[model samples]
Target: MTHTITGSAKLLARVRRIKGQAAALEGSLGEGTECMAVLQQIAAIRGAVNGLMLEVLEGHIREHLGPDASAAQRAEDTEAVVAALRSYLK
Candidate 1:
């Protein structure tokens, strides 16, 4: 979304942090870290990713599906969001 572009710096920072988390997980595996710590790292990565998704998705809904949109437009946007969610969940 255009708003996301305007706010790209913040989103990019989150992505970078998530990438770092994944890299740390890889390093832990390479170094034979214990299973519990590895699992915790994986969970941290998942939470970061989920948080990023929520921010983007909320922005999209607010910008595209707001009250000013026509009924048909809202319906279409809602469908598109549902499809995206379905794919993401899979």
Candidate 2:
């Protein structure tokens, strides 16, 4: 029970960090930073966002959508994950 709360806290921390990174990237651009450096920061932030998404999706699959899940539940989880991946790729 407490673990769930702690896990959510950790996730929130990551999301906040990612938001900070995005803001920093914007600030760098507005500051007339070099194009290559700005692009690198953007790529780094995008990777971090993708990594966070992957972690959350994997956690869902392992904890809530395994053999213990009902057919309907598994199907829904699968669809959600697929949609997430599709959006990530696009």
Q: Identify the leading candidate in terms of TM-score.
A: 1
Task: Assess each prediction's global lDDT (C-alpha) against the native.
Answer: 0.95, 0.82
How do the residues 1-90 of candidate 2 rate in per-residue lDDT, one tens digit apiece?
232455898778888989999999989988999999999999989888887887777777776687888999889878988897898789
Model 1: runs farther than 4 Å from truth?
Answer: none
Q: lDDT by residue for model 1 over 63-87, one digit each (tens)?
A: 8899878899999999999999999
Tell me the TM-score of model 1. 0.95
* Structural similarity to truth (TM-score) of each candidate: 0.95, 0.83
Task: Let me know the TM-score candidate 2 reaches against the reference structure.
Answer: 0.83
What global local distance difference test value does model 2 have? 0.82
